[model samples]
Target: MLWLAFHFRALSLEVFSRGAAAPAPLVVVEKQGSRTWVIACNDAAEACGVHVGMAASAAQALADGLVVRRRDPSAERESLAGLAVWAGRFTPSVSLAPPDGLLLEISTCLSLHRGLGKLLKQARSGVTEMGYAATMACAPSSHGAWLLAKAEIEKAIREPARLGSLLAALPVALLDQPPAVVEGLERVGARTLGECLRLPRAGVARRFGQALIDELDRALGRVPETRAFFEPPASFERALELPAPVQAAEALLFAARRLLPELEGFLSLRQAGVQELELACRHERRDPTIVKLGFVKPTRDAGRMQLLLRETLGRTRLPAPVHTIVLRAPLVLPLSASSGDLFQARNGEADGDLLLERLRIRLGKDAVHGIESAADHRPERAWRPCQEQNHAAAAANRHRPLWLLPQPLPCHDGRLQLKSGPERIESGWWDGGDVARDYYVAEDRNGAQLWVYCDRVSGEWFVHGVFA
Candidate 1:
């Protein structure tokens, strides 16, 4: 069935603002152990003036007793991601709605997981053990359960038809109405959903607009709802949490070994390769770190990447031990195919290309350059510098060497051995300095294939480019 996703942002943000849920005198700290206390009474916590958005310092000043610590967003996100991964075991369709929220399709999974009650308990325990409290609801519709889970008077409402009545007593706030509409409804003594439902639809629509009716319609299962679940990519990048915080480079490389195979599998599934990727880690008592690598061309060979990364890992020293890791690549391309004639063709030469690209990332863009054709007859002006784009296209043009020296070198004297010539070209006459050159192919003394041309009027020879 559908599930209600509850995000206790107020509670999480308290931990984000401070390390723990600090104790307030008016708040009931149910003793779990000698030093372990759970915030048992939420009302008492609120009664002690521990409201959301109220600064920890302010709460302490107001209550004279409070606990606090630095917030850890990375740890929180990691925990959420881990929970999302675990939830996948129940349903393939899992939506991580962020900051302590999850939307799972339990319709198909309900029977598999032993009904709604058992699944809810499992989810609750899963999150609870991960260090977060969750109130769950499963209904025929997602919105209906979401309302139940978020209600102040919390209880599971199993029967679908009985859901409307359960929501009838809920506050207007639960309807997701604008603050002004809630205020207006409160003024009119319409404190419940049932009371608002009793009002004329036309009047409500005219006064509060369609937002009120829309949310109600969603709650009642009159509208269609869909969740966009994150799809697993063909080639994946993953970082593992260290068993303990790690500082030595070898330790980080060892952890990456566990993820490399999975990444390779993901690439194989997509029939693609990992030409570019990154590895990130969070060190002990330090911020998270990132190490990105790329290839000259697309490749799926985990062994190659593993070796390269191992080398990099060995070279780099950590300032502090690492606690977690993250790997990512903004783009991934297909592997190149090579031809039988090694020197003449580059049907499959992705590895070299990807390697060079990785070097460019480590170095800078200008560090690498390729030759591109220019529409000009002058030998030097015929070719221009360009960066690699379509790997396939670049491979196909491998028979054509890219580096044509910036300026054309002067060719042999007077009588030129022009293989092919007189492809006449003339331009820029009206603007200022005009050109009149006849392009040609010629053989040099060293027997190198050179793109040469002759100045029609001046009768000068210049070597423009090289042919493979």
Candidate 2:
């Protein structure tokens, strides 16, 4: 079996720094009694000599304009769980690796992705797009891949025979052991895995206990490894709190873009598409300004969805400063495969759907509507306005005029030429209005086709519509 490990080095800092305007010198601090200490630092913070375990006050003094945030274990865990769900798109057997890592069992699905190299490239690119920098490694054993990823060794050791040689070269400190065991190993001149392995097994077991031996055995593939794979949640509701309040609605788009990829990944894993979603802009003092987005077709494409969202946001006027944005997809439908006709010319149905989606967002949903066939048989009441339309169903079985008048107009001139025979209409008795007429396709004096009908009871003609 092949195992892929992703190690997010500075998860806490990365999670908080996602939508920041500039890469500032930021550090995550933990409160210890009365003193606060640095737990994680970004690249800018590290460059200015801010290291983990350093006092927060000392670090701030060393670097000007340093940003310090308290470490949130819950946020870090939530981020890790979200990443695990995102990784489920690549493989079914995905497991969370604690504070900032993931393990994916991908051996069974390697051929489907062509090979390991392409799969790794896609996974790394996807992770980067989701606003996180990760180091990845692949190995025969799960723990071995985790160690390699932590060490930033981008190697794929699939062969069991090569696992020993490669893992032995890694430092003994990379093993998942107690601090005392690691210190004792270092004091005994066993600074690397190879040195520790060279010592007699019985003596090492007696000194380090059975747990250390089991850990080593697991990493080296001497025993079987089992993990509880992560399961994605049924519904998606992701919210991002901005670093600062956004006054303009358009300004929120930058933060919203970061959430789109995660949504896309979630939909991909579920093999579903969303028809409607709601974006709630949380205000500081007022109620949240909500923008409801409806799509003409169910879609999972992030780029198309973002384009529609930008158009909607461009026209929105914020009531107050927004501190947080929550995106929720309330309606998700199964996505079906579609294929185009090879023999005929391409139809612009997809393009038309996109245009309708954009128009619905730019204008109000009530303002933009589609024409659908109604149950009434009368020409004026035969169709109704709806949000979604089926063009194929509307065009079926009968020919109708391009334009219909609000009420039938009396035809005074008797010199009209008839092109088609009369079609009888005898319905509408169930309602209050009753109509019994013989409709005919007639041409007027100007050579325009007019839809005229003769009233069966009065024997009078009226023009109802015109053909384009």
Candidate 3:
């Protein structure tokens, strides 16, 4: 089995710094007994002479505007699991390596992704888009791939015969063995895997115990290794915490843009589209401010989603500065796959409705309405307002006027001359409001076309609509 491993080297710092989401000079610290030490630092912090293992006080003394944050194990794990779901878009067999690593069995599915080169390119680009730094490596064994990733040796050692030689040069400290075992190997002049392998197998196993030999065997693929695959949730809901409170609703899109692509990946794997979404912004003392978005039709396009969100946020007013934002898509519907023609042309009408959708968000859902024909033949009751876009064609037999007045205006035949013959419309007898009239298209003296109908019951003529 070929395993591809991704080791997020700066996950601890990224969990808080959040790249452009919070691009401040930051350092993540941890407490060892009494003294706190820096565990991770971003590039901005590094430029200020802030390095890992330095005392937190020393780090602050060196950097003038550095932001100090403590390491959060829970957030790291959540971030890793979220990435695993994103990785599901590329392959199905994904295994979690806690404390920042992911193992993907891509040997069986490389062809599906257009071979290894394109798959790796997409995976690396995706990690960057999610605002994290990661190192990736592939090998014949899971342990070997993981070790190579951790060591920052970015290469794919596909053959089992080459894995041993490449793993031999790696230090013993990169192994999963206990500190005591690593120290024991170092003290005995076995600093590298190659040096340790040169020692007598019986003596080495007896000295460091069988676990060390087993680890080595697993890395070399001499023994079988079992892994439990990661399973993503049915729905999508991810939260992002900003380092600083943001007052402007539009400015929050910088961080929010990261989650959208991930959401697109999730929906793509499920072959579904989301119709409604909820963007909840959290404040200090007040409840979360929810800004809901609706679509005319189901869609999983991230670009379209982002566009609608930007328009909605522009009109939204924030009650307080938001510290956290959560994106939720609860309603998912099946979206069938559609292939473009050879020229890659898309339907123009669907694109035209995007403007309507944007206007609907900016104004209000109730403000905008589509119209469709009704069953009644009366000019006033011929059509009705619809809440959503209806593809059904308007049912019509004879010519009808679009600009119908609310009540027919009384007019004299002397001022108007009839141009077309009478077209009778006499339907709607079951209800109380039944009508029997002979409608005619007429031209006014000033050349304005009018739709006049002769009332059969009243023996009078009235103008209902203008054809202009």
Off by over 4 Å in 3: 19-22, 338-345, 389-423, 429-432, 438-468
For 1-468, candidate 1 gives per-residue lDDT tens digits of 566465554443323221122223332232234442334223334676676445444555656444443344565565455455546546767777565566677777778778878877766654543334666666666777777767733455657678788888888876666799999888888888889999998898898898888888888777887768745543345555443466777766756654555455455435456666788877656666777676554666666677678766765657777767666655666543342123213544545554565566556657886666667644456556676655224233432335566677787554445676557778768657687877777666667766776778888887767887
Better of 1 and 3 by TM-score: 3
Name the lDDT value of residue 335 in candidate 3. 70
- Range of the 10 consecutive residues with the lowest summed lDDT in candidate 2: 337-346
Off by over 4 Å in 2: 21-23, 32-34, 43-54, 62-64, 111-114, 337-349, 389-392, 402-417, 429-432, 442-450, 455-463, 466-468
User: What is the full ranking by lDDT, best candidate first?
Assistant: 3, 2, 1
lDDT to native, each model: 0.61, 0.84, 0.85
- Which whole-number lDDT from 0 to 100 does residue 130 have in model 1? 36
Which one is best on TM-score? 2
lDDT of 1 at 355: 58
> Which lDDT tens digits does candidate 3 get at residues 1-468?
889999998888787766245477889999999999999998889999999999999999999988899999999998898888888877778999998999999988889889999989989988887888899999999999999999999998899889999999999999998999999999999999999999999999999999999999999999999999988888899998887788785668777777886787677778777888888989999999898888766677777788888988888889999988898997877776662111112666556557778888867787898888777777788788896643666555445677889899898656888888699988788888899999999988899988899999998999998885
Superposition error at 315 for model 2 (Å): 2.5
Q: For model 3, give the 10-residue run with minimal summed lDDT.
A: 336-345
Provide backbone clash counts, one per model.
18, 0, 0
